[model samples]
Target: MNNIEFIRNEEKKYHDFCYENYKLFEEGSWLYKPVKTVMDLLPLFDNNESLNVIDLGCGVGRNSIPIAEAIKNKNGKVVCVDLLDSALNKLKEYSKQYKVEKVIRTEKADIGNYKIKPNEFDFIIAVSALEHVKSEEVFEEVVRQMPEGTKNNGVNCLIINSEVQEIDLETNEKLDVLMELNLSIEVMMNKLSSIYTGWEVLKTVVNPLEYNITRSEKPVLLKTNAITYVVRKSIG
Candidate 1:
């Protein structure tokens, strides 16, 4: 299936609530807090080097526009990568309207198979967009392709579904599947770090969380919002 199909399938079946709650996540709402939390990590941007940031699986520019606004004054720029044309088109228009167009460059492509420079980015963000990636191998591949040391001293932010948890159902008292929507960060450092020791190249990893309790208390099992780690990434 194509990216849109992939996304729609996930949203409709697993995360329809997040999609339906998009308006609140759009600008200034409680749901938008997570996006804001993601941008707050930008303080790590030293701005000494040419700022090259990447927004992986950027959906409609929620986090992209905010990052662009924050770094527009500096010699910084953002590259938003996504698999959906609909999201890219909307990001284009929003960047223009927000007056950060000059600082934002968007690309329509799949992260699972895209050819990106190794360690080229000063920052890489994957906000609320990992569950859709599905396979651990694919997820690792995306990281493997990252410009290795190019992100030296850089930060990579990620939001994904944490390990599944069990919830007791009121009806039958049987345990049900529940997961925490997680917010995590990975940093790229020079020397080795504890939080990062996966593929020789990753520097460090970071995690900061802000979650929304699913509004519905229906019989359906619901997941929680959780922020998992804080680490670094470096290339081999």
Candidate 2:
């Protein structure tokens, strides 16, 4: 296969993997918790004014629900975008359960194809999402657009799996490896700093994690090097 085809195949495999295991994102599952990185940025929003938020790859309203609750009284709304219909439906249900349904909207779309309108959102989040894009070009394009997609002084938070190695937790057999950036942490940080020049970078962290998964009724662990970027656009 050519490079484009290889990338497409990999993207499809990842999507199919998530779709097949959609049950793991059910409301009661461990995957249904809000991300701490996203939560920590909540206090930065203007409490007296309504805000428009967009969450890319917002699976099952894990982060979306909490955001909705945070902004519900402020006349804020959250636009949730994801690839899976099942996941979006669950988000809708969870929104109602949390009584934030009025302020939550769901859209089903692949993040790779989803376009962000300029100056459209007050807060934008892409947690564990953008790394799945098919190519470096697409990834860079998405990152480049994020600043323009936000309103002046708007905030954007992103958490991505930069590199990972999958292993069986029981036998410790190496299963698979995925490196979205394939660049070292230092290089990645430099690239981000260069990209967001003139913008305020609140936090940049590289966190290594051991994520647990189940394959063939066996526990598997993914050793991941994740990176987070929290940035705010300046009113210019």
Computed on alpha carbons, the lDDT of every model, listed in order, comes to 0.58, 0.79
Give RMSD to native, each candidate. 6.3, 3.3
Q: Per-residue lDDT for 73-185 in model 2, tens only?
A: 99888999987766787778778888999999999997887888999999999988887776677777888888889998889998887767779888889975543445566
**Candidate 1 lDDT by residue in tens digits, 47-110:** 4546778888776677878888888878788889887665677678778888999999988776
Q: TM-scores for all candidates?
A: 0.65, 0.85
Instruction: Tell me the lDDT of candidate 1.
Output: 0.58
Q: List the candidate 2 regions with Cα displacement exceeding 4 Å.
A: 1-32, 178-183
The Cα error of candidate 1 at residue 173, in Å, is 11
State the number of backbone clashes in model 1. 32
Which 10-residue window in model 2 sums to the lowest lDDT? 23-32
Q: Given candidate 2, what's the lDDT at residue 205? A: 87
How far out, in Å, is residue 180 in model 1?
15
